[model samples]
Target: MTTFDGLPPLRDVIQTHGLVAKKSLGQNFLLDLNLTSKIARLAGDLTKCDVLEVGPGPGGLTRGLLAEGARKVLAVEKDSRAMGPLSEISDVYPGRLEVINADALDINPLEQLTAPVRIVSNLPYNVGTELLIRWLTPPTWPPYWASLTLMFQREVANRIVAKPGNKTYGRLAILSQWRTTPRLVLELPPEAFSPPPKVHSAVVHFEALEKPRFEADAKVLERIVAAGFNQRRKMLRASLKGVKPEIEDDLRAAGIKPTDRAEQVSLEGWCALAREIAKT
Candidate 1:
């Protein structure tokens, strides 16, 4: 029944510490403990796993992760204002929680935690997509964490789970689905936050595959996907001009139509195209 090991309610913690959400930091405090707990639960059983959290405004989600039985919680917060509030949680959990007063972008939280880790966070809006992409394209396969449970602007959630031929489908869908199975788990209206964002938000879960769904150099695949979607309305033969002229033969060999647009190409199709381009 204790909240965050014994730290006070997030609101009181924030006020007592004079912590205000700074627009420059892309902070929108989630004060609803119930909602934060919901996000922690969405990460499945954390009894034995380490958890990494980013932009933990007032430690709402951080507390939930620890309370849900995470063996350890490494919280990276860029805002100096939240340190005092988070310190309270650290004292409550003692050795169970570690708070880093650093920007999520600068630190590799995964490397700092033990294996069998799950990254669960209500990410800062400005850096959410960039962070997700970094995790998805880690130099090695089976990157540090087992899965990612992240909150994003609802539009971004759509992109992560978008399928080929859907309007929402594009580079993000192509890249994400190529390496992980992403699913939308929950949605929150703007009202969920102390200062509501203009747009709705959603939590998307990504379970990284041992190997990619298809084979191709990650770099090459990224290039091809970016080129294809850069001019999405154009035909593949036209959109992929940067991929060498001989790419058409490979496309045909892979059973992809040269006239197809980027939106019409599946993740598998993109992999096939990248493999073809890699040969040249």
Candidate 2:
């Protein structure tokens, strides 16, 4: 069996290499190169920059990245079984794709990657949210990556781009909206993946902002938001009590009602509240 491209079909490659999808690694191998290509194109002009792909199982998306004229692709795959197939892609692309057999979480792109990079991956389910948070809230502004085109469980995707008042809106919505403009580009059904995960999946594209949407201490905002949403059922007055001695005063100064819930506050409101908390 051959794929749309000249290479052997991904299913054949998987069988040949005995690359069974491992539940522990959160692997649901994407077997369709065409679908992968669509995801690659969603990242915009890949020719201008390098791409960092996580969990490149059998290199389907890896091949898509390289095929779409990405200057280079640094694909990190923890599954040792994929080395052979990924090596085949490396061989064909020759220096265009570098397969690093390591954990994506441990790789700091700032130290290891070049400028004008884009992170594109069908991220392993187990670590997808963790990795996205890292990318969303980098220590430095104007992160190394030019953009992030990632696939996440639809529920997580909704939360990341969810706006105030949306049921899915929560910490992820606030955190993601603060620093990046995220858009849901594509929604893929479960059948799109080989193992067919129980839930649907979607691709989200995030454009990194030159600066945060508003001004506030990063740590203060993080702490304040965590507390505000700590017991979401509780109103701000109760939830934020421990954040300051005069929590109600802080809320009033920020123009937020003490009775309001976290989901009711806008990004500007959160930043304002963070500044008020800092006054204590």
Stretch of 10 with least lDDT, candidate 2? 106-115
Evaluate model 2: give its lDDT: 0.90
Question: Per-residue CA lDDT of candidate 2, range 82-116, in tens?
Answer: 99999988888887888788898887655556778
Give all candidates' CA lDDT scores.
Answer: 0.88, 0.90
The number of clashing residue pairs in each candidate reads 0, 0
Q: What is the lDDT for 251 in model 1?
A: 82
lDDT of 1 at 216: 88
In candidate 1, position 20 carries an lDDT of: 80
Candidate with top lDDT is 2
TM-score of structure candidate 1: 0.96
Tell me how far the alpha carbon of residue 219 in candidate 2 is from the true structure, in angstroms, after superposition.
0.9
Residue 183, model 1, lDDT? 96
The residue ranges of model 2 lying beyond 4 angstroms of the native Cα positions read 1-4
